[model samples]
Target: MLLSVEKITKEFPIQKGLFGTPTAYLRAVAGVSFDIEAGEVVGLVGESGCGKSTVGRCVVGLHQATDGRVLWDGKDIAKLSPEERRTLRRRFQMVFQNPFSSLNPRQKIEDVLLEPIAVHGLFRPSERAAAVQELIEQVGLSSKDLQKYPHEFSGGQRQRIGIARALACQPDLMVLDEPVSSLDVSVQASILNLLTKLNRDRKIGYLFISHDLQVVGYISTRVLVMYLGVVVEEGRVDQVLKSPRHPYTQTLLKASLGASVAVKGEQLSPAQVVPGCAFYNRCPHAESRCSNEKQDFQEVDGVWRVACWKWHKIG
Candidate 1:
């Protein structure tokens, strides 16, 4: 496996009052597990604060997993020593959701791109300039933009720079957290195309996190639906998108199609921590079983898996 996440959980303690001790735990990612093969793109789809970004961070070693293991090439990343983890950093990289915030405003594009190479000692001082120039061209940025600071560029351009910097380490796996969500529709396509091209040419595996189902459907081979820090559904993109088995997945599709206009009650708050199924309260077809009993993932087909009790009944 290129990457394997086995029962990985991340919990954040909620502090109450001014001198509050931890009162409650917000389970961001609760026992999530999946695997990605080499050169494959796995899309992680969910509403905001569903812990998709947190899971991505855990996989890339940004946040140490609160439970279970994140095995990359048969090694648990959480167990790696500081030096070992630093060495393993070159094997995986991440592109953040916000391009503007990810880059330094004062640093020139070239410096930002070259910093990874310098830190990893990948290139000599004399060769670093040429390497930076090559990276700029690889990401479809012009060498002329090398001297420009991040604020001088448009949002799309800044994202392109982020992509270039992530690629500087020649990473085998990339966790892209809403890479195109911040750009214009027109620019989003261009960035997606660039990512697609990079995957094909470089054979880099991707864990793409996004709430935009349409974008995920366009690029991902497989889709994993997350809710309340748990994966409710996982399947091939077409299978899941066209015929979603979970009620939450169906609701998400409906929301994507702008069906929220017809819904009568108050919209479900995405941030609220749910008890059983994260989507149970919002699901139109939700039953008492949904609210009381936690669902477990079960295979319906060779390629599809869902965690809903009513999945068998739903076509």
Candidate 2:
């Protein structure tokens, strides 16, 4: 596995006052687990605040998980020293959601790309300029654009530049958190295609996080559906999207694709702990046992898995 997240959980402490002891915690991610193999695109799909982005952040080491482990090539990343982690950063990178905010307006695009190469010492001083030129071209930009500021480009073009910046590190896996969510529909397709082509050519695996199912289905080979900080269903893209077993996944598909029989329920908070299934309140097929007993992940077709106790009966 290129990346493996084993039951990782992230919690933010909620303080009572300016200097008071922590009273509670907001559980953003609750024991979410997944893996990405080399050259594989694994989509993590959910609505806002479903903890999908949190999972991506944890994978890239932007956030230290409160519990469990994040393993890189079978070694726990949390155990690495700061200097070791810095050296290892070149192998993994992240692309942020908003292109407008991700880049520096004050710096030229060339300087932006050069910073990583300089920090990582990827190339000799004389070779760095040619490397930057190649990086810009790989993402479909010309050398002239490198002299321009980030504010000069459109949203889509800026996003392409962001991707080039990530590529400068020559990473093995990228954690993309809603990379195209802020772009126009036509622009979104271009960015998605660019990502697909890069993955194919470079064999760089991706953990694509998004709230859009259509985008996820288009880019990912496999999918993990999450709700309220936990995975509800996971399987091959076609298996889970075409014939979803969990109610949350079904609800998302219906809501996104205009299907009927939509599941509905009151909005719930991640901090609100449910004794049983996190989705028990919303599941139409939920039973008394669903609200009483916590459900374990049950394998369906040897590869597919669901956390709902009544998955067999629901779908």
Candidate 3:
């Protein structure tokens, strides 16, 4: 396995007053487990606040997981010391969702890319300039772009810079959090193509996090559907997208196409609540048993797993 997330859980403390005492916990990621094989792209799909980005941050060591382990190449990152973790950073990198916000507006592109290389001591000072120029060209940018600030480039160009920075250390795994969601359709297509080419040439593994099912379907070898901080379904991209076992997964597919076009007799309210099935409130086929009993993930086929009671009866 390239990466393994075993029973990971991340929670945030809620504060109610000025001198805030911890009131309740907001569970962002709950008991999520999955494995990514070498040179594979695993797409994590969910709504905005369903903790897709949070999970990505934990995988990259930005946010320490509240519970469970993030294993990279068989080493548990959470168990590593500060210095050890810093050394391990070179093997894994991240491309954030918003390119404009991720870049330093005050700094030139050269400085931004140079920082990672310098910190990791990857190259000597004399060779760093040429290396940076090479990285620019690798991402399809001109050497002239090195002198310009982020604001001087278009959204797609800024993203290329972000990709170049992430690749500076020659990482094996990249956690891309909605990398192209902020760009125009044309720009998004271009960036996606660039990423696809990079992956094929470099053999880089990716943990792609996004809410757009269509986008995920386009790039992922496998798909994992998340809801209310938990995984409800997981399978090969073709299997999951074509025949979703869990009702939540079905709703997500339908809703992606159009809100009103979802399962018949189901009108999903934004504030809908489900006591058991996180998707029970919006699921058209919800039964009394769905609301009373919690479902556990069960493997249906060799490659597909689902956490739903009515998988056989959903049709």
Candidate 4:
């Protein structure tokens, strides 16, 4: 395995009063587990607040997980020393949802792309210029354009630059947090193409997080359906999306409109924890057990894993 996310969880304290000390907590990601093999794409899909982005952050070391393990190359990244984590940072990187905010407006593209290389000490100063040129060229930009600032490029071009900057470290795994969500449909196609080409050429693994089922279906080898920070279903993209077992998974596929579903359900609330199933209130096929006992995410007849008590009965 290239990366193993073992039951990761993250909690944030919520305040109540003006000088609130801490009234409640929000579990953004709750006990999620999965693995990404070398040169594979694993898609995480859910609604806007289903903790998809938080999982990506935990994988890339942006957020310290409140529980569980994030293992990279067989080492638990959370337990590593500061220096060790910094040194191993080059092994994985993240591409944010928006390039405009992620990239600096004051810095030129040359410096932006070169910063990672400089920090990692990947090359000698004398050999740096040619290396920068190669990276820019790989992302389909000319060296001449590197001298300009990020705001100088179009949305798609700026995204390409963002990708190039992530590639500057030559990562084995990338945490892509909705990398194409901000671009035009036509532009999204080109950026997706660039990512596909990079994966083919570099053999890099991707933890792709997106709300679009169609996008995930197109790019992912396996898919995980999340709701209220929990992975409710897991399977090959075709099996899970074509015939979702969990009610939440079924709802998400139906709402995407591109996927075929036999029953439709409503979007969920990302509120405080419920003792039972998170989808109890909105599940189209909910029963008494759904509101009383939280279902376990277990394998079903060696086909796939689901957290629904009625999974076997779902058609």
Candidate 5:
């Protein structure tokens, strides 16, 4: 496995005051497990606040998981030495949701892309300029724009720069957290195509996180549906999107397709840790067992898995 997330969980402590100790914790990601092979694209789909971004952050080392392990190449990342960690950092990169916020307003585009190369020592001074030109060109940008700051570009152009910045590391995998959500529809399509081309030419694995099912469907080979920090359903892209087993997954598909599905339960809060299935209240097919008994991940055909005991009845 290129990357393996073994039941990784991340929780944020909710403090009573600025200086006080935490009174409670908000579980942002709860025991989510998945693996990504080299060159595979796995889409993580969910509604807003469903912990999609949190999962991406955990994968890229932006957040230290409160529990469990994040393994890269069969080695636990948390256990790596400082030098080893620095070396490992070059193998994976992340592109944030907001391009403008992620880029520095003070620095020129060349400096932004050059930082990673300088840190990693990927190229000597004589070779660095050519490397930066290649990186910018690979993302469909001109070498002339390298002299400009981030704010001078349009939203789509800024996103291309963000992608170029990530590519500067020559990573094997990328964790793209809604890379195109902030752009116009026309701009979104161009970014998506650029990403597809990058994957095809470079064979970079991707963990694409998004709330939009259509966007996920367009770019992913396999998809995992998350709800309140738990993966409710997981399968091939066509299998999950066309024939979703979990009620929550079904509801998402309906919503994406402009078909309305009534939410049957009360609003759920991630802070309120449920003993049973997280989607119990919201699931129309939820049983009494779903309210009290924890749902184990059950395999359907050895390829698909769901965390709902009532999936069969719902299907």
Candidate 6:
């Protein structure tokens, strides 16, 4: 495995005092596990605030998990020393959801691309300009834009620059959190195509996180559907989307097709942590057992996994 999320869980404490006393903990991601191999795209699909971005951050070491391990190349990043992480930084990188906020407004495009190389000693100062030019051309941007700042570019161009900045590190794995969500629908295709080309030509593995199932269906070989921090369904993109086993997955697909899948399961409290499946309260096919026992992942057809107790009975 190029990257492995080994039962990763992250929680944020609700502070009640200035000294960081916790009154309660908000579970952002709960026991999530997945793997990404070289030159593969693993798509993570969920609604907004479903802990998609949090999982991405944990993979890249932006936030240490409250529990569990993020293993990259057989090593747990949470256990790595700060210096060790810095040394291995080039091996993994991230493209944030918001391009404008991620890039520095004051820095020129050339400086933005070259600075990481300079800091990591990937290239000498004399050779940095040549590396920057090469990356710019690779991302379908001109070398002339190198003199411009982040604010000067349009939204799509800024995103191209953001991608170029990530490529500057020469990373082997990239966690792109909604890389094209912020752009125009027309422009989204070009960025998606660029990402596909990068993955093809550079042999880089990707953890592609997005709320759009259509985009995920088009780009991913495998898809993992997340709901309230837990993966309810996982399978090949075509299989899961075309014949979703989980009720939540069905609802999503139906909604996308302009059909309403009424979500009238039960009244659910966001703060309540249940022992059973997180989607149980909202699962149209939920059973009585689903209220008491947490559904464990089970193989249905050797290629797909489902966490719903009544997955076989659904549809």
RMSD to the true structure for each prediction, in A, is 2.1, 1.2, 2.5, 2.1, 1.4, 1.7
- Each candidate: what lDDT? 0.88, 0.91, 0.87, 0.87, 0.91, 0.88
- 167-254 in candidate 4: lDDT tens per residue? 9998999889999999999999988898889888899999999999889988888898888899899888888888888877776777
Regions of candidate 2 where Cα sits further than 4 Å from its true position: none
- For each candidate in turn, the TM-score is 0.94, 0.97, 0.93, 0.94, 0.97, 0.96
- lDDT for position 286 in model 1: 77
Candidate 6, residues 104-218, lDDT tens digits: the string is 9999999999888887889877888899999999999999999998988988898999899899999999999999999999999999999999999999989999998889989
Write one digit per residue (lDDT tens) for candidate 3, span 184-238: 9999998889889888999998999999998999999999999878899999999
Candidate 5 stretches greater than 4 Å from native: 17-19, 265-267
Candidate 6: stretches off by over 4 Å: 17-19, 265-270
**lDDT winner among the candidates?**
5
Q: How many residue pairs clash (N, CA or C atoms closer than 3 angstroms) in each of the candidate models, in the order given? A: 0, 0, 0, 0, 0, 0
Model 5, 27: alpha-carbon shift in Å? 0.8
Residue-by-residue lDDT tens digits, candidate 5, 176-281: 9999899999999999999999999999999999999999999999999999999989989888888888888889999899988977755488899899988888
The pairs that clash in candidate 3 are none
Q: Least accurate stretch of 10 residues (summed lDDT) in model 5?
A: 260-269
Residue 222 alpha-carbon offset, candidate 3, angstroms: 0.8
Worst 10 residues of 6 by lDDT: 263-272
